[model samples]
Target chain A: MSESRGPGRRPGRRPGVSDTRGQILTAARTIFAEKGFDKATIRGIARAAGVDPALVHHYFDTKEGVFIAAMRVPFDPAVIVPLLLNGPREEMGERLVRFILTVTADPQAREPVLALIRTAVTNEQAVAMIREFMTDALLGRAAAALGIPMLRMEAAFAQMFGMLMARYILRLEPMASADPEELIALVAPAIQRYVAP
Target chain B: MSESRGPGRRPGRRPGVSDTRGQILTAARTIFAEKGFDKATIRGIARAAGVDPALVHHYFDTKEGVFIAAMRVPFDPAVIVPLLLNGPREEMGERLVRFILTVTADPQAREPVLALIRTAVTNEQAVAMIREFMTDALLGRAAAALGIPMLRMEAAFAQMFGMLMARYILRLEPMASADPEELIALVAPAIQRYVAP
Candidate 1:
């Protein structure tokens, strides 16, 4: 149970610190896949990876962090939560819309998120994993931070989520081709009502 | 090509009227998949089905109707467009939300639409086909009927589209578990802005 050794650990087989990170991620994926987001624990992941629990905390800091890293999510809540909170309450909608559109504007950045969504739609386990993660990690955190009701925040998120599908996945125009500013102007007030109301 | 016979038709092998309808649907699917919604014409589908273009029109009055039949869409725009137009303009948002949620509430009704969406997210041809059909037959028609910009209507549709994904596909709660009326209240006003503004 030591940081250096566990039942699954073999002597003289440690590649390095980076390898430890890889092993933890590998174990995290398995644990997350098997138990989903809510039930998967850092201690469990660490045990599965043959490392101590402290090392899991040391590497990822939190379960949300571990999920984000493991999933290669395009946006970080650590960065995004502050971005939403630091801005003026009135402008939060515009900021949120712009931020999402900007991040997803890049094909490379958008693909993995789209892949997750694609998986979530067809696969029940993926849905559970993603739903729990988004509810707890992203929307729950932001709703609490903004002092908004979780349902209202989710409504706003759902609107944005749909827009992303229309614009990117379905490529429905003028949504797909409209300038980001135009979308912000059209969608911001609606989002602001949920977040700031 | 005649209604009774064409190059692909075999002599003394006609099944029945229902078989012809099935043949048209099958051919429409192939034509739509190959040429997309915009390019796949009644003539093309009829030619592929080994029937007269008049027979295609007689069976399914328009390309949109054919698409709906071929795809087994849960809702029809012929019914939906009038529903949007006939209502009090201010309440169009509520009507739209209620209708969508209600129709999709049935697992039997919802699955094919979800399957199309699932196909759409990953498949370029599906996206193009759905996009054109939606833009031309559904949103475009509704927008013109209501004197709203097509872009605005599309944005509204996107909001609802995202909510459906959140509610059903992702089953994100309380979005998934919340009362339908609660969602209609939270979302209707946002939809009204784009739709009735």
Candidate 2:
């Protein structure tokens, strides 16, 4: 949809919808960097983007949504949370392991996630952003939905996170070169214990 | 022990044992960085340090030992493998988790390990160095000693590695703040499965 343009229609006077969305994302990145995830508000991001707060909400439903968009994460919790919950409880671990490994198997999709992880390791601001988003939007929601303890969920996440580091970043073999099915078989049972009600 | 000082010896002529040890570590770091863990050799490191290869062997029993010294890893496989194997088979997981968390709890001891992990994520050479060292020195030894498959050992390590990332780097709460004993309770069983004969 196009924004109404005044008669003058100067190139800079009236921005398009995409332009506003881009502006919001850019502002979100800067604000997230400066203030981190906890302190960065939608209002502040909208103000920085020169847009109304309502517009920011229209584009991204919540702060977590905004962060995910700004970070260009390949998968969305909106999508992933349901996937985790929809499966039979016993198979949750297998699904989680398979989904993560399969999604990250593609280098193009994995780069942004890996980059964010690398940044989180070195930068406190990045860590804050990642921590809040992961806890609130991802792990918290999954744990609450499944009625599992938050600690268990975090532990499960940690296990998968480590496996990814081993497979992709560290390239530790057998883990690195093993077929996806093999890893799912080896790791799923352990993950099952973490998520079982 | 003091080295003999020949007549007309200058301050630089006869280095103390600690100084020579430091020189070897310095050279090991450079060589490992340049050639990665696999290509780097003890002879090459000794030659770079202007010492005999035999001296390098005398000081560091193996190339992995040189890497451990150069990296300032808080724990050594020489100590850890035995610990893992000496324990009751079922309790190995608990011991492993407790040991890792306890050692890394000290910020002073954890920094170098975390720094290495941070470096490994972004740098190809660092990844190679970590991969070879971990596969050969740590996981290989433990898997062989326990008579378990290498894949199982690597997976177990991956779980712990990821937990460390969550606790220390990501600082994801619950996992980050949970009592070490509590974690041992939750995680030990999964680890037991991996290491069990």
Candidate 3:
């Protein structure tokens, strides 16, 4: 219980500086990574961060709140929506796969993806959030722009996500270690056909 | 703790036909089905079964042991290996996919498949078991028989299991509702290509 903040009082009491909140996020990310979502506990995080559990609650009302803060996986349709929205129907799969590989291959984007998969099986809320993020940001924008039926959009996601989960999450030997380009090459067409005009 | 067996063994004979074990399996199955592993607890299963925690432990060494018993999923590689081992190179995909879909479509085969996925996320041992089940029974056999490398085999599994996880486990619309035949038709060729000579 190293949390110096008295109950209900903001820890920093300083404007534009949130060192403690940042520390908490750091601690939460480590714990979530180490223990996964379900097994990691608030008490454990507070113990790790050297902060009061109360402060954790104050900063984040629930575990889900902490998860959102810790992961910070942006759900903005802003960045990716236009990628799918502006694409030609026939080329959507190639574009989508290429975009995904680019996003995931970037160092910054990789960690959140790892966190997402780690939590999907361990936390129902995280699983729900993943589905929500996909449906709201990527799939919804995609199906609408391409004028494909909603079902096809979901099918495409199922295929795409399954590949990621199998390759990255489960670390299945073949897919887990495949050359990204080869993976993209094989999978891109499947994606293309799913939403293609 | 409504256990038939109390602390320190009774001198009398054992309970008839192991009624409590059956009860525990039932409760565990229900809990696992409803909660999908992360939330299901042995204590909870025992309580639901009107038995003591120790009795639950007595029957199954750990929660995992309980899970292995309760889910009762057939994780046989030897039985499944032969089915996949036969047939010409060209028809392997169709034969393999047909076998998987047809078997899983059956009520008996489906439950264990669900249980396997549900538990794989929450329990490390469950993950190990599933990995063994797939590798030993299915993946390794296919790779060895087809003379493909391990990496390609894993990639194929990523695709196959990914499809199964998305379509069956999450039951994410369209896929959950799609005709199995249509799914096999679209995806079987991909599976075939991955495994074929």
Q: Which structure among the candidates has the greatest DockQ?
A: 2
Q: Model 3's CAPRI class?
A: acceptable
Better of 1 and 2 by DockQ: 2
Candidate 3, A29-147: lDDT as tens digits: 66786677877888888766667899899999887788877665433456655776675766767878887776666544455555665676545666777666566666677677778
Kindly list the per-residue Cα lDDT of model 1 for residues B1-197, writing each as its tens digit. Answer: 11333336674676577678877876776666445455578998888887789999999999877877876555567888888888698899999999988987866456546656665665565577778878888888888988988889988988888888888777877888899999999999999899899
Q: Which candidate gets the maximum TM-score versus the true structure? A: 2
Report the lDDT of model 1 for residue B22: 72
Model 3, span B56-174: residue lDDT tens: 99999888788777554443555545666676768777776677677678654565566666566555656766666566666787678778876666655666666676666555556
Task: Give the TM-scores of the predictions, in the order they appear.
Answer: 0.68, 0.69, 0.67
Q: Best to worst by lDDT, what's the order? A: 2, 1, 3
The CAPRI class of candidate 1 is medium
Ranking by TM-score: 2, 1, 3
Complex DockQ, candidate 2: 0.62
lDDT (C-alpha, whole model) for all candidates: 0.78, 0.78, 0.66
Of all true interface contacts, what fraction is found in model 1? Answer: 0.77
Regions of model 1 farther than 4 Å from truth = A1-72, B1-72
| Cα RMSD, model 2 | 9.9
